[model samples]
Target chain A: MARLTTPLTDFYAVIPAGGIGSRLWPLSRADAPKFLHDLTGSGSSLLKDTWDRLAPLAGEQRVMVVTGRAHRAAVEEQLPELADLNVVLESEPRDSSAAIGLAAAILEKREPGVIIGSFAADHVIKGTRFFNMAVAEAVEAARAGFIATIGIVPTEPAIGFGYIHATEETELEGAPSALKVDSFVEKPNAHTAEEYVESGDYLWNAGMFITKAAVLLEELAKTQPELHAGVVALAEVWDDHAKRGPAVDKIWPTLKKIAIDYAVAEPAAAAGKLVVIPGEFDWDDVGDFASIAKLHSSGYKKDLAILGEGARVLSDASSGILITDTGRTIALVGVKDIVVVDTPDALLVTTTANAQKVKSVVDALRISGRDDVL
Target chain B: MARLTTPLTDFYAVIPAGGIGSRLWPLSRADAPKFLHDLTGSGSSLLKDTWDRLAPLAGEQRVMVVTGRAHRAAVEEQLPELADLNVVLESEPRDSSAAIGLAAAILEKREPGVIIGSFAADHVIKGTRFFNMAVAEAVEAARAGFIATIGIVPTEPAIGFGYIHATEETELEGAPSALKVDSFVEKPNAHTAEEYVESGDYLWNAGMFITKAAVLLEELAKTQPELHAGVVALAEVWDDHAKRGPAVDKIWPTLKKIAIDYAVAEPAAAAGKLVVIPGEFDWDDVGDFASIAKLHSSGYKKDLAILGEGARVLSDASSGILITDTGRTIALVGVKDIVVVDTPDALLVTTTANAQKVKSVVDALRISGRDDVL
Candidate 1:
């Protein structure tokens, strides 16, 4: 939430890092997920990079990470810049929509105009300047009673990601604001993905939202009354816990498990209250290992070896990805685009397309009592 | 040449372990060629195994290895049973014919009519009973003044190995009389290989020969007069330090670099002096990594991790040719009759047909300056 007109030193960021990230598995484990790995060895993790970009808009002290209790240690270890108190440990995964509402409840004492811009932890964002500008625009829009969602300009007909059917821009007083959203669409097949790309009205739903705590809470209260009531109850005990401490574990399970977009944002959009901010920022929720391959320049399409191809950002020798200890040789031959993740005990080699299926492998291993592989 | 009918003691065996084995690059290096590796992991080298099999026939004290100077240490290390005096180290690589002739010159002085069964170090001999019996028969034939070579029974239309053409059995007073070798054929194409298999008269040239020093020398004199003269001139100083010593070192370069079969056996076969002894042994000359893979039996044909499906001669999960170990836990994928060699630097995925082409890959690598891969 923003507390300044120009650039907020008091604005807040809520990141949901609880997803299993199965698609990026072998690399993303139970202990560490996609956010923690510098899939592109650009000296910053997806989460850390996301935080670095957001820190200018929202201050570091005000930003919060909602991750699993198991991953809290890893997340903190990766991002030592984060204050210990700022990490909101989720006892169990309750989905992203619920996570956003929970963050609002915890920071309820902040002013009504305090704008919260929720970002995905595992996204590849280009055009950082443009992104910061877009975030600033959303904060301004949020201050003016509008719940803003940034829609990505689709580059290709990608059916893998969610889509947003956005309306025309309506010039606002403070900022050149986009119009209210018409609808949200799930990932479609190739035909629909192509159709979505052709149709200029459809924008990639980037799972990013900008809204004041008060308006978000009000919308939740109106659209998702059950979730709102649960949050309100939790908020009653929020201050006591903020000052002294009591775990929020008991309240989370009782609350209906649902995404905020499903219970509130979609309903709010349908009810003619949600606004789609048409903004241009090269944003990618790097969903799998294949996407991570795209993050850097390498001989990805052909078989290659990085013997001393020094200072390679992301050395992906054919299928093998290496985050080497500086100038280590990564060699490969006859291996296709597989994700050869070489950790100490576990070695995962799966097709990049089948990275999402890695969760199935882990599940099968667990069922077969081969916990050693996991 | 046949002075005694009985099996003599103190018989010497010479193994030429000098060839670069270029086709088997990564696995067979100059420092550690095919003979050095435990391709037949019977707790011995291929050279050692050959020696072990032959030691009973030729006493251990009389077993001599004719290898390049560089490979002398490895040769001795592999066959520790052989004393330092027995391993005759060559200064340079002369062809096989010259090598055999050189060994003959050395053995002539030790014992006249010495039965030397020249065996290749890198062959897989199955059915030891059949092999030893066939060897004994060949030995008797050799004593009776026949230039004998053991020809293997053709199991398949294998275009990779050379063929021996034997028209009819010779009526001779020996253990199992020799077959009159019509001629020797070079490695054939698919059509010829198929025809050779169907004809039943053609046998795989086993590269195994059995003959006395005098018999071979006489045959060389009758068939290859020029080579016979050269070998005789080299052998004249058998007891002296002139030709018997490093005289061939100067003369060998002048002699044509030719295979023994081409220089002598083919000429002899054409001259009606050659005998083909049908090898009853199940011999597999492991030509490349693929030949090594045939020894392993696993349920999966593709990407096999040989956790040993059956109780065979030898089995090790960690060792065995891997086609590719890109960290993808291969299910072996229910394949039959395949050779999968996996190396950290390179992977060789091929059926038996293409196994020989692995040499082509090595050649290309060498040409391309990929010495590191080798």
Candidate 2:
């Protein structure tokens, strides 16, 4: 993978920022989602980090953001360099298919054959050099008339993420590291995930798709004709400020809620039209406190890690993570693998082994009509 | 033990309110100690509870509190019905010997042969009828010229508290329940405590000392003459407003720092002048979160107990206690036996197993110069 110095010609980056990240409740609320937070100790919000990462590959002017109307102001404020016309604000969420498809349709409407790359705003990626080279190869693969997705090279036999089955024999002409996608697999059981990792033929599907805007819309048209038609109709009047609101209000809600993988990528893979670029860079979804604890492992003292700025923590014989949004002094004593998330209005106490079960807490809160904390 | 109806004549209650309760940190601070908190969900602070428990036995006019000057305002506010002269404010802590001895000396000066019963402000006692009966019998034993102390009947082989050895054959003339004290033992090891509990000759020494003010002073004078003389000097001018401050500033610091058990009870036990009144009422020192959890076991939902007013908590598959002062919505998921104390400035996260180790956290904070939170 060769590192490119300049932005790829006609390559547009589209960031679809949605999902409340319920597992990350108290920190990631309905109003303030995970993308708006700095889960990594990166000093910037995930959305801003995403913009910065893509700005080098697809110049600031060519990058676009597709987010819900509720987060439009926050997204705009976070990325002030973003052009007014580039941000596609959805009236309501119809899942990833509608979000990415609408961005592609609008980009195609603005300029035909423009190569667009869709990246999730909340995913964290390390190794800038490797990331740039992977994106460059992905863009090259996309230029070869195939839908390209960057699949993270598996570091562990993780059952938490979906995997992409790729073949080393079939390769795109221009992109050397690119492998033909055989299929996309859902999150596997412990045994199956071990087998996948051992075979060395599968990669973690990180939802980074790169392809020509026209090709994506064309794929969407073949698979989900109703959703493609609805997005296309909305895109036609999207540039017209007076007509955009009315068009979205009429068509957005009617569109079926589906993921991009189920609607486009999986079908394309079956048709032998999709290619996967194995990204060697470290990546994380920052899904829970356990991931956050791993990301900030460097800050751990005696196996205890403290996240968030101005977190005053005193730990003794404790092994775990303390994520404090409020500047309260948190003291931990003889607790092993514990997670203490201290916020102004809400607090979460659990253990690293039980990080995934935090979703149950949020679900219970919602059931108990405690949506205010959510 | 027979329940007494009226307040006993010539008996005054002196509560020695001290100890920062470092093991209960974030909830118990230096300025706001455990005595000021309602660790048991009794709807009032431990100090106020002590006052209430004693007012029935000694009457409101006969009950007095001896606390540090820093906590004078708070103690006065909590026990507003207390006469201004009865609240003894120590300029600097000289341990239990000085605090209790000073109260006794002052009471002796006011009225000769006055019986003063000393109780800690932070202890929790249940079975008011049994407690009143114990106090009445102890008062009878005190009138018979014995340094009477109420010892709790052993419920378990607890190594956390000191034990009293009493001889049932040698009984007080007036108080039939009172037995002659053979010795006072410090906290024993697991095996020794088990033996003591099985033998049935031991009772938990709850630091409840009842004796004539003159007898307490005379005992203190023999064991710690310098401390006894200093307190007697301070007591002479304690009633004079202008001279009280000067007297305390001059004599309080010179007094020896010693517990009443070391200065009087232990020595008196050896001399066969101490009598143990077996108290059948359940008693607790409220020393740590583990004890608080046990005291509030009724509030446990799926093994999780919450102690505090207006504490909004949501727990799932989690056991242990949450003591909240900040009224935050606390959610615990898949954590067992965890202790979380949420305060305005400081928060503590541990487990019931690690409750005793909380003292180390406070020690670390103090060494790091975080006295503001302490």
- The global C-alpha lDDT for each of the candidates, from Candidate 1 onward, is 0.67, 0.90
Give lDDT tens digits, candidate 2, residues A233-330. 99899888999888888999999999999999999999988999999999998888888887877646348777789888887788878888898888
Write the residue-wise lDDT of candidate 1 on B81-196 in tens digits: 88765666666766777778767766875677787778887777877666766777677777777778889989889776999999787876665547989989899999989999
TM-score of every candidate's chain A: 0.86, 0.97
DockQ in order: 0.13, 0.86
Shift in Å, residue A56, candidate 2 = 1.1
Q: Model 2 off-target regions past 4 Å?
A: A298-302, B298-302
True contacts kept of 1: 0.01
- Report the lDDT tens digits of candidate 1 across residue range A1-374: 22333447546888888776776545566677778867656677788888887776677777888888898878888778788767777777778756888787767654445778788898888887667767777766777778888888898888678898976675655557567788999998999999888878888999888888878888888767887877767666765666323437666776778887887779878887677776687777877655665554354555322211242222212343333223312233334554444443343444455545556666665676755444
Displacement of residue B295 (Cα, Å) in model 1 is: 4.8
Clash list (residue pairs), candidate 2: none
Predicted structure with the largest lDDT when compared to the true one = 2
Query: Second chain only: TM-score per model?
Result: 0.82, 0.97
Chain B TM-score, model 1, reads 0.82
Give interface RMSD, per candidate: 7.3, 0.8
